[model samples]
Target: MVGQLRTHGELRTDTVTRAFATVPREAFAPGAPLEQVYNRDDVVITKRDENGLAVSSVSAPRIQAIMLEQADIRPGMRVLEIGSGGYNAALIAELVGPEGEVTTVDIDPFVVDRATQYLAEAGYPQVRVLLVDAEGGVPEHAPFDRIIVTAGAWDIPPAWTEQLAEDGVLVVPLRLRGLTRSIALVRERGHLVSCGYELCGFVPIQGAGANAERLVLLQSEDIALRVDGDQIVDADGLRNALTLPRVARQSGVEVGGFEPFDDLDLFLATALDAFGLLVAKPAAIEAGLVERSTRMGAKTALEGGSFAYRASQATSEDRTSFEFVVYGHGPDADRIANEYVELIREWDRLHRHGPGARIEVFPTATPHAEIPDGRLIEKRHTRVLISWPHLTSS
Candidate 1:
């Protein structure tokens, strides 16, 4: 597993690679299958709620390695980890070594108990395991040099910033627009700027920081729209529109099989006026209610009741290349789809080969004039700004 992580460029530093090599991932989950513990990219679900939804999990090894690399932890630096599972805490313990302190916190007692027992059993007894809501960070152990949040967070709580050391790094899997990106941010004056971000997903954080994404069901339990923040969704009107005739448009954009287009998703999420993720079950796709691409949340644009979602068309018999396509629904289908397609083309023309978006988080008290020109989104704790800067050709 460590070898695979190194090959994939996730285990960048020698210290991180050694941590991966040293930690016993199987010891944390006693009864889980060996294949599961050794899986390179799959997460092990540790706890679930009454509704059968995963509430806590040991994140995938790939994500753990990526976040650890982003963190750049060194010996003798105190680190705080939010949303605990025994394995990740053990990994941090390995990186921090005997000289440093590692504290992992969670809101649920059951999860905390499991993590505590497992960490002890895994030979990481020195790591502190606390059952506390991380909304108010562990103030008792302040001035952490590195803070890594494993759960998907809606916003950057003020306590996190308050407790972060002057030169600390806070790596969180933050939810922006409707997409989740594990952002590595550092303090900059009155704001925080991202050094880098990686595509990732995690079980949502619980307790005071819990802000679950709203799902608007359009086709019973099969199809729904996943929205975050204050994006107003008309469930009744959208449901009616979903049954209307489909309008499809093809953008003159082609992509190779292994090419990464997740950046385009971020561009649309920030550039579009109103955006949400259109998700559907496999049955819905097989029944022709939506395309196969939508099975894993598709980027969607909304105009009142009308909506449009992104899709793709295979351009090669070997299915090694594909063209971007858009599908629309409702009275404003044509306009929504045309607008969506234009943005697709614009991304392909400009940012497909350029640096990705610059994301920053600032306190709500920060004046709008001080913030950079971009899509400014207001949250309870902080305001997020996303800007795409143009590059100067040499």
Candidate 2:
């Protein structure tokens, strides 16, 4: 697993590599096959909710390694893990060594009990396993050098920033405009600014910090729009718009096979005024109602009764390359389609290979004059800002 992580460039530092090598993952996930336990790309689900959704799991080793590298944990640094899975806590314990403190907290008592037993069995009895709401943070262990969140968060609570040390780093999978990225943020003056981020997904957080996305179903449970914030939409009109013809426009941007375009998704989420994720089931796609371009829903721009989403067409004989395309439907299909295509071209020209977007988080009460120019996503505790920098060749 360590070798695979190194080859993939996820395990960059020697400290994280050694932590992965030394920790016995099997001890945390007992009764699972050794092959499954060691698989770097698989997540072992440990607990589920009444709705059959995964509430807790031993996260994929690849994600674990990526977050740990982003964290840059040292041998004697105190770390707070917001989600409980015995495996990751043990790995953190190894990284922190004997002198440093490691506290793992979770709202689910079942998860906490399981993690405590597994950690003790795995010889990491010194690690503190607590059952508490992560929104409040572990105040008893305040002022941690590093706080790594394993669940998907919609906002940065005040307690987290208050509990972090002066020069601390908080690595969290934060959701913005319906897209989630594991952002590494550090405090500067009074606000937190992002240093780097990676695309990731995790179970939605529960408890006081839990914020659910609004799902507007267009066709029963198959086709829907996952919207964030108070962005109003004409649900009935959009549902009727789906029955109208779709207008397709080619953006003339070609991408090779297996190329990642998450940056483009993030760019569109910010550039557009109203955006949401268009989710559809296989039945809808098979019936020629939608395209199967992305497994995790399609990036969509909503304008009143009209909506446009991203799609692609194969440009090569062997289907090794694809061209970006936009599909729009509604009263103003042509205009929305062209608008979506223009943004696609702009991304290819300006930000396809640039430094990407810079994200920063400030207090909600911060004056508008003090904030930077960008898209502002208002959360309960913080105001998230995303700004794109222009790249110039030296």
Candidate 3:
């Protein structure tokens, strides 16, 4: 079954494909609605509480595959699955086989109970389900071959690193700026080195290891963007733009098969440059609202206005399109859109499609710091790290 399933999915091997098929997703999702249990789509929200918010869920199959591949798991491996819900642990167990050991942990005791019962009922009782704060990890089962975080973490906690075995791999969804990226970190010579990056979104990692949410306030309009920092610069121009009257708004636009995905860092850097003027000055930050359009486009609303503009173009078009229902002349439309257009073209100058692309996260604390002469990297307030060369390299 796994072999056959592999032919249809993005996975490379029949082994993983089989594991997915054999693991009846329904068993682990006991309380989940039928549609979600059988749906092979994206993540299925399973546990939402009184406040009407999602607290836990079964990750999408595609995401599961991506993480598993990034983990580069091997048979007979000792693995640790954080924020366990039984479904992912069950999949890992199937891949690891009887010879391998899988320790699954969750902060909620009830979640652990459910995972244990589900795994036992499924006849894979060998999988250990522990009720503990996974943020600190299950140190008793230290030195895991691979540690997979099912939730999102704003920063890599030191404890997880300390528990990692030499050469171990840790797959986590790291939140950078406001975007989440799936990161694979390998323990190399006592250091956690980046193995790879993938575009992703996941629930925030809870517990003592959680990071404080960064909040951004848009002065005039109701749009507030929360990243992990207060160092938002150049928002003045945007703030001033907010004083304009609203005339029109477009829903959104679409962009696909673009080079940005190939190199997210370059895409972000270009975005920062193109939008830097707005991000740098106080006027811009207070002026408007910015929201993600399709993977390649963005929707922005002028200040004191409710109208929106969708920026996108045909897949084959040489020049991208900025589609908008202008409000009251949208006097600044051409200048703003042209600024974005120029930034997108700069992708070629930096070669944003591959390797040289890098995304750097800055901590919310101090605005500036000194780097040691011989060190290439400097840790930032446990939540961020900035490379020495990056400051002057640009």
Candidate 4:
């Protein structure tokens, strides 16, 4: 697993590589097969709810490695880890060495009990495993050099900012507009600014800080929109639109067949005034009701009684390239489809090669004048700013 991580460039430093090499992952998951334990890409789920949804898990090795790389944990630095699993705490203990403090907290009592037990058995008894909701942070160990959240967070709570040391960094998987990015944020003046971000996902946070995306169903449970904030979802209007003919438009933008367009997804999430992710079940796609993109949550723009979603068509006979297409439905289909297509072209022209959005979080009381120029998303605890930079040479 260590070799695979290093080969893929996920393990960028010797200390982290050594941590992965030394930690006995099987000690945390006793009955799991060795093959599953050692799989670098797989996550080991530890507990689940009554509905069978995973509530606690040991994250995939690759993900842990990459996030640790972003964290840049140094020896003798205090670290606070939220959403504890025994294995991750062990890996952190290795990075912090014997002198440094590693405190891991979780809301689930079962997770805490086992983590405490496993830490002792694994020779990491010094790692503190606490049964507490991390929404307020561990006050006894304030001013941590680094804070890493292992759950998906919808908003930045003021406590996280207050507990972090002035020069400290916080790495969290933050959900924005239904998209989750592992953002590494640092204190800049009175706000937290993202130094870098990478696409990643985690189980929704549980307890006082939990806020999840709302799914508005268009066709029973099969077709729906993953909505964030106050995006409108006219279910009856959209159900009627899906039955009517779909209005389609082609954008001149093209991407290599093997290229990743996650950046384009981020662009649309910010550039559009109203956006949600269109989700679909296999039955809907098999009936030719929606494009395949909906299976992976397609980028969608919504207006009253109307909506448009992004799709793609192969441009080459061998499928070596693809051109973006937008499909709309309902009363204002043409206008919504045109607006969606124009944004696609705009992203290609200005942001395909330039820096992506610069995201920042500030106190909710921050004056509008103080907030940077960009989309201002109002959250309960903070105001988020997403500003895109200008074009750069390819």
Candidate 5:
């Protein structure tokens, strides 16, 4: 697992690699198979809600390693972990060494109790486990050198910044639009600026900071649009539009089979005026109702009675190369489809291989003139700005 993480560039530093090699992951996930516990990509679900949704779990090792690298933790630095699962806290304890302090907080008492027991049993009794809504952070342990959030956050809470040391780094998997990215941010004046970000997903945080996306169901429980922010969605109109014929347009952009295009998704989420994620089940794709683009939904643009989403089709016999395509439905299908295709072409031309988007977070009360020029996503607590940096030709 350590070698795989190192090879994938997730575990970059020796300190992180040592922590991964030293910690006993199986100790935290008792009763699970050793093979499963050691799997780098699998998450050990420890608790679930009445709805059977995962409420807590030991996060996947890959994500853990990626976030740890992003954190750049050093010995003697005080670290506060937002979500507790014993294993990650133990890893952080190891990274920080005996001179540092590690505190793990969770909203659920059951999680806190289990994590406390596991930490004591796993030889990490020194790590502090607290029961509290992390939205407010652990005020008693303020001025932390590193604040690592282990859950998906919709907005940056003021307490997080207020408690963060002036030179500290806050690593969080922040939700922008409907896409989630684990960003490493540092305090810049009164706001946070990104040092780097990675594509990731986590169970949403529970409690005062919790914010759930509004799901607009189109076809019963099979198809839905996951809308974020204050973007109003017309469910009835979108449902009726989906039944109409789809207008398909192909953008000459071709991507190799193993290539990743998450950056393109981020671009579309920012470039389009109104955006949401188009989620569909396998049944919907197999029934020929929607194209087989993404299992977790495709990036979609919503405009009144019209909607368009990203789709792709194989352009080679070997199926190793595929061209980017857009599918539109509604009264303005042709117009939306053309607009979506043009954005894809624009991304490929200027930003595909260049520096990706620059994301910044400012307080909600910040004036529009004070915010940077870009796509601004307003939340209850903060306004997120995403701008693409210009690249220089070598």
Candidate 6:
């Protein structure tokens, strides 16, 4: 894997390249499927139920490369890995070398045991594997030079920020409402700064750091009104539009022969920016109908009559703009589409470009605490409300 990474110019120097080539990936996988053991693509299927929902897996090679580069691992650097996957720990160990230390922790005991064995078999027993909740992070090893979370975290836990060594780098799949991004945060002068790295996907982190899944099942009699920032329509207007027919359902548009889920999320984010609202539902879950997943992005149900809505938007893999196929017996779909178009026009009027805006995240436990007074931003799915006064122009 490291050899291939070097071929792509991922390894900057011969010393790093040699270390990667010497580390055999097969040693870590141990009797895994042949296709997965050697396949350079993202093929590690860590968790699969009888129904085949992939709960966890090692991320792809390119993603690992991107993260490693962002991590900036150096010799004699102490590294702590959240969600103990042996492959990632081994890579970190290899990068940090013998003088440095690598400790990996996982929430699942079985995963930790397996990873420990795998590391021993691969001659990397030096990498410590622990069975503990990683969201809280392994504070016992305080002041780590670098910390990486293999699983996604809904927020930058104060524990993580507090434990982070000054001038340390923390990399994790950060969940923002409906989507998750591989965030690279560096602690400088007690401030965690984001590099706005590429938007990527990862399974949501479970346990303490996991967020509430916002897709609510509606009751039979209720209704939801959907709106985005690109349009000015409010919840009431959406209720009126629910009387119309669906406008575009499952219309497939491919970009470079690949479904553009990012593009769709961007579109949705745009709507959230102008309208400041998203799908809304009645209090009851049984009233709504299950909406099917799109070929590219979100799958929503029109259960009951309403879904949540957001007033402002930020583009993310989870919050991109895409047309949804609503399943309620109302005009909600038409209403949302019309409002979306209006929001787009307003964006043009205000000279808000369809692309490029940095999303800054600050996580807090209380709803009232840390509320930005200048400009409001909303994460539609989680009903998370925030504001970035500084990001208004972009």
Ranked by TM-score, the better of candidates 1 and 6 is 1
RMSD of candidate 3 to true structure, Å: 7.3
Which residues of candidate 3, in runs, are more than 4 Å off? Answer: 1-9, 31-35, 215-222, 232-240, 245-266, 269-310, 315-340, 356-394
Q: Using TM-score as the measure, what is the rank order of every candidate, best first?
A: 2, 5, 1, 4, 3, 6
TM-score, model 1 to reference? 0.97
lDDT of 5 by residue, 105-140 (tens): 999999999999999999999999999898788888
Position 356, candidate 3: lDDT: 38
Model 3 lDDT tens row, 263-296: 4232533244221111213334244433233223
Give lDDT: candidate 1, residue 176. Answer: 91
Report lDDT (Cα) of residue 253, candidate 5. Answer: 95
Candidate 1 vs 4: which has more lDDT:
1
Predicted candidate 1 versus true structure: per-residue lDDT over 79-182, tens digit per residue: 99999988988989888889999999999898899999988887889999999999999999998999999999999999999999999999999999878999
List per-prediction Cα lDDT, in the order shown: 0.91, 0.92, 0.59, 0.90, 0.92, 0.56
Kindly report which residue stretches of model 1 are placed more than 4 angstroms away from their true locations once superposed: none
In order of lDDT, best first, we have 2, 5, 1, 4, 3, 6
Worst lDDT 10-window in candidate 1: 385-394
lDDT of 2 at 270: 94
lDDT of 6 by residue, 140-203 (tens): 8887989888876666666777777888888877654345567777753334556545466666
- Candidate 5: pairs in clash: none
Q: lDDT at 249 for candidate 3? A: 33
TM-scores, all candidates, are 0.97, 0.98, 0.72, 0.96, 0.98, 0.67
